[model samples]
Target: MKINLAALQIASVLALGGCTVLPPQPAPAPRGGTATPAPKPQLPAPPPRPAPPQPQAPRADAANWRDLPQTPGSWTYSAESSGSAVRFGQPGAGPLLAIRCDRTRPAIIVQRAGFGTGTVPATITTSSTLRRLTATPTASAAQNAAVAFEITFAVRDPLLDAIAFSRGRFMLEMGGAQTLVLPVWSEVGRVIEDCR
Candidate 1:
C-alpha cells in the first residue's frame, strides 16, 4: 500500500510540473513593420491670434497767419440796452471780431480775439485806405472772450466809414493771429449809423 501511495504522489508531482502556469504573450506586430505608434489620440488645434493695430500720423501745424484758410463767415448785428455790436463769425459760434458801441460814452470799440500781452499794433486795410492803430490788452470789455486786443474810436471817426464803404472787403491783421478778410457788409454801416 505504501509503495502504491508513493507512486501516486510522484505521478501527481510530474503532472503539476508539466502543466506549470505562464504569463500571456502579446500578438506579433503587423507585416507593415514600422508599427506607427497608434496615432497619439488626436487633439484639436489652437485658435489663431489677431493682428496688431496701426498708429496714426500727427497733423501739421500752420507756420504763419497767411497759411490759414479764409474764414467762411459773415457779419451779424445785435442790439442791447447798453449798446449795439456787429460781430464777424459763424452764427452759433463766438465772434472772431467784434465792434461794440457804448451808448453812455458814445464810442466804438473794435476788438480782435487773439493771444498776446501788452499793447500791439493792429491794422485794417481797405482798397483806398490803410489805418494802423494801437491795440491794448482790453480783456475787461470783452467778457467771455479768451484773450483780445482792442482799440477805441470816437463815433465820428472816419475809419468806421472806410470799413463800411470799402470796396467789397477789408483785411484785419495782428501780430500773433490769423488775418481776417472780412466783407464790407451793411451790418457794419448799421452799427455805425446806430451809434451816431
Candidate 2:
C-alpha cells in the first residue's frame, strides 16, 4: 500500500541515467569548400636484376685450334688430270676446302656462302706462322649461279708443313674478321704427302 522513498529515489536516478544524451556531431562542409585529402602511403622500389651473359666466339689460339675435334667422314680425295685433289667435306657433298695439286700449279681453295662481289684480303694462320692471301667472290654464271666467295692460294711447303705436322691451330681470317678454323688430321697429312 505504501512505497519506500529511498527506493523511489533510486529508481528515478536510474531512469535519468538511462536517458543521458550523446554530444552533437559537427555539420558537413559547404559544397564550395575544398576538403583536405588523406596522405598516401609510400612504398620502396624493387631492386634491379643482373643481365645474362652473352655467348662468345672461340679464341684464335694454337691450343684451341690444334685440339679441334675431328668431324667423322669429312675428308675426301679425288682424281684430276693435273694431279690429285683432296676435298674436305662430307661424302657426296660440295667441298668446303679443296687442295688441288698439279705439276703446273698447286693451290688450296676455300669456298663459303654469302660472299658479295669483290676481292677480300685474308690471313691464313697455322700455329704461330701466318700467311697473307686474297679471297675473290665467285662470279654469277649460268653453270655456277651461287652467291659465294672463295680464297685460293698457291701451295707453300712451310704452310702445309705447319698445318699437317705441327701442334697448332689453323685459322682463316677474312674481311678483318676471323671466320673459320681448320682442323688437321692424319688424313690431311697423308693427302699433303701424296700431293707432294
- List model 1 lDDT by residue over 1-196, tens digit each: 9999999999999999989888886666789785555457878888887888686321121223233445689888999787899999987888889988888898998898776666777787766677777888765434444477888999999888988898777778776567787888898988888889
Candidate 2 backbone collisions, by pair: none
Which has the greatest TM-score? 1
**What's the TM for model 2?**
0.51
lDDT of 1: 0.78
TM-score of each: 0.60, 0.51
Q: Give, for candidate 2, the lowest lDDT window spanning 10 residues.
A: 65-74
- The pairs that clash in candidate 1 are none
Q: lDDT (CA) for every model shown?
A: 0.78, 0.62
Q: What is candidate 2's lDDT per residue for 59-161, written digit by digit as tens?
A: 4444465455443335566666776666666677766666556546566555554344567777677765777867777776344344556765456667777
Task: Supply the global lDDT for candidate 2.
Answer: 0.62
